[model samples]
Target: MKVLIADDHGIIRLGVSQIIKEIDPGSTIHEAEDFDETIRLLNAHIIDLLILDINIPGGNNFQMISTVKSKQPDIKVLVFSAFSEELYATRYFKAGADGYLQKDTSPVEVKSAVNTILSGKHYMSQNIREYFLQGMIRKEVNMNNPLAELSDRETEVARMLVMGISQTAIAEKLNLHTSTVGTHKYRIFEKLAVSNIAELIEKYRIYDYS
Candidate 1:
C-alpha cells in the first residue's frame, strides 16, 4: 500500500508516517507540506491512501477536498486535524472525506479509524455521528445561498477576507508569497460579484455569524 501524508508540521508528518509504516511495513510513504505539493504528488503517483491535515500552506481542506474529489474521485482521504469534531466533522463528511478524526485521538483509535476506512467504511466519532443525525433530522444546517463558483484557493481567501482578516495577515497565515495573495484577492472579488472588501464582508456576514 502507498500512502501520502500532507501536513505543515514536520513532527506530525513524521509521527503519522511512522505509525502507518509500523502498521503496514509494505506501505510506501510520501510527504507533502503544502497544498500544491500534495496535488503534485497525487498527480504523479498512484496513492492508495491519503492522510491529510485540515490546514496547510495553500488552503484548508474544504478547498482541497473538492479538488481531490474532482481529480481523483476514488482516492480515500482520512482527515486528521486538531480542530474540534463539532466544528469540522459534519462539513468534512459533507465534503466527501472517508474518515474524520482529531489529532488528539489515541493511537489505537487512529489505527482503528484507518483500518475502518480501508475496509470501505466511513468512520467518525460517535458524538459526531449523533450530531450529524440530530442536525439532519432537525434541519439545522444553514441554508444560505452557496457562494459563487470560486476556485478552491480563491474560496479560502474569501473565507479569511470576510472574517475581516488582513491581506498581509492572510498571506502569512497561508504561507503564500504576498503577490499570490493579491492575485487570489482580485479573482475572489470578480467571482463574488462584489466591488471590494466591505461588500464582500456584508455578503458573508450571515455565514460568519452562523
Candidate 2:
C-alpha cells in the first residue's frame, strides 16, 4: 500500500511513518512538509491514502480536502490537525476527508484510524460520533459549547487569539487580510459573549474547547 504523510513538523511525520511501518512493514510511505509538496508527491505517485494537516502552508481550509481529491479522485484523505475534533472534524468530514485525527492522538488510535481508512471506511472518534448524532437529531450543531457556534475561520482566529498571537500575525499565518482577521475576532467575541482577549481566553478555558 502507498501512503503519504503531510505535516510541517518533521517529528510528526517520522512518528506517523514509524507507526505505519509497524502496522504494515512493506507499505510504501512518502512525506511532505506542506500542501504544495503534498500535491507534487500525489501527482508523482499512486498514493492510496493521504494523511493531511489542515494548517499546512499554502492550504489551510476545507478546500484543501477537495483540492487533493480533485488530483486523485480515489485517494483517501485523513485530516491530521491540532484543532479539536469538536471544532473541525465534522467540517472536514463534510469536506470529503475520509477521517480526522488530532495531533495529540495516541499511536494506537492513529494505527486504528489508518487501518480503518485503508479498509475503505470512514473513521471518527466516539466523541465526534456522538456530536454528529446529536446534531442530526437536533438538525443543528450542538451549541452547548459556544465555541461550536464559530465558523471554521473564526475558530482558527480564536485559537490564535487565545494563544497570544496578534491579529496581524494571524492574518499573515492564515493568509487573510488584517481587516478580515479583525472581523473574525469581533464575531468570535460577540458569539462567545466576551469583550476582550482575556475574556476570550477565560471562556475558552471554561469550555475546555481545546
Candidate 3:
C-alpha cells in the first residue's frame, strides 16, 4: 500500500508513520508538513491513502477535499484532526473525506480507520456516526457550531489572526491585500460572535493552537 501522512507536527508524522508500518510493513509511506508539500507529494506519487491534518499549513478549509480529489480522484482520504467530531466530521464527510479520525484516538482505532478505508469503505467511529445521525434528525446540531459559518479564506485568515499575525502580515503571507485581510477578520469575528482576540482564542480552544 502507498500512504501519505500530511501534518505539520514532526512527532505526529513519526507516530502515524510507525502506525502505518505496523499496519503493513511493506507499505510505502510519504510525509508532508504542509498543504503545498502534500499536494506536491500527491502529484509525484500514486498514494493509495492520505492521512491528512486539516489544520496543516494551507489546509484550514473543507475545500481541501475537492483540491485533493481533483489531483487524484481515486485516492482515499482519512481526515485526522483535533477538531470535535460533532462539529466537523460530517462537514468533512460532505466535503468528500473517506473517513474522519480524531487526533486523540487510540492507535488501535487509527489502525482500524486506516484499514477500513484501505479496504474501500468509509470509516467513522460510533461517536461520529451518532453525531452524524443526530445532525440529520435535528438540523440544529450543525447549526450550533458557530465556526462553521466562516468561508474557506475566512477560516485561514481567522486562524492566522488568532495566532497573532497582523493583518498586513497575513496579507503578505496569503498574497491578499491588507484591507481584504481586515475584511475577513471582521467577518470572522462577526460570525463567531467574538469581539476580541481573547474570545476568538477561547472559541478555538479545540484547535489547541498552543
Candidate 4:
C-alpha cells in the first residue's frame, strides 16, 4: 500500500507512521507537513490512501477534500483532525473524505479506521454513528432539527461558538470579516431559535448538534 500522512506536527506523523508500519511492514509511506507538499506528493506518487488534517496550512476547509479527490479520485482520504467528530464528521464525509478520525483516537481505533477506508468502506466514530442513527430517527418524527438546517459554513461557525470562541476570533480564524461572523451568528441564532450564547450552548449540548 502507498500511504501519505499529511500533518503539520512531526510527532503525530511519526506516531501514525509507526502504526501504519505495524499494520503492514512493507507498506510504502510518505509524510507531508502542509497542503502544498501534500499536493506535490500526490501528483508525483500513486498514493492509495491519504491521512489528512483539516487545519493544515493552505487547506483549512472542506474544499480540501474535493481538491485532493479531483487530483486523485481513486485515493481514499481519511480526515484526521482535532475537530470534534459530532460537528465535523458528516461535513467531511460530504466533502468526499472516505473516513473521519479524531486526532486523539486510540491507535487501535486509528488502525481500524485505516483498514476500513482502505477496504473501500467509510468509517466514523461510534459516537458519530449513534448521532447519525438518532438523526435518522428524529427525521422520521420531525424533519425540523435546527442543526440539520444549517449550511456548512453555518455549522462551522456554530461549532466555534459552542467551543467558546468569540465571534472576532472566529472571524480571524476563518479569514472572514468580523461583521460577517456577526451575520453568521445572527443566522445561527435565528435558525436554532436561540437568542444568546448560553441558549446556543445549551441547545448544542442537549442535541449533540445532530
lDDT per residue, candidate 3, 10-104, as tens digits?
99999999999999999999999999999999889999999999989876777788999999999999999987776667678889999998899
Candidate with better TM-score, 2 vs 4 = 2
Model 4: what TM-score? 0.74
Better of 3 and 4 by lDDT: 4
Task: Judging by TM-score, tell me the better candidate of 1 and 2.
Answer: 2
Give all TM-scores, in the order shown: 0.68, 0.82, 0.82, 0.74
* C-alpha RMSD for every candidate: 6.7, 2.8, 3.0, 4.1
Instruction: Select the stronger candidate by TM-score from 1 and 4.
Output: 4
- Residue 132 of candidate 4: its Cα lDDT? 77
Q: Please say which candidate is ahead in lDDT: 2 or 3.
A: 2
Reference-based lDDT, residue 6, model 3: 94
Model 2, 46-125: lDDT tens digits are 99999998888767767788889999999999999887777678878888999999989999999999999989999998
107-188 per-residue lDDT for model 1 (tens digits): 8888888888888899997767786777741244333333424555676688788767788988887678889999999987
**Model 1 regions lying over 4 Å from their true place:** 133-210
Give the per-residue lDDT of model 4 (tens digit) for 75-120.
9999999866765787788899999998989999999999999998
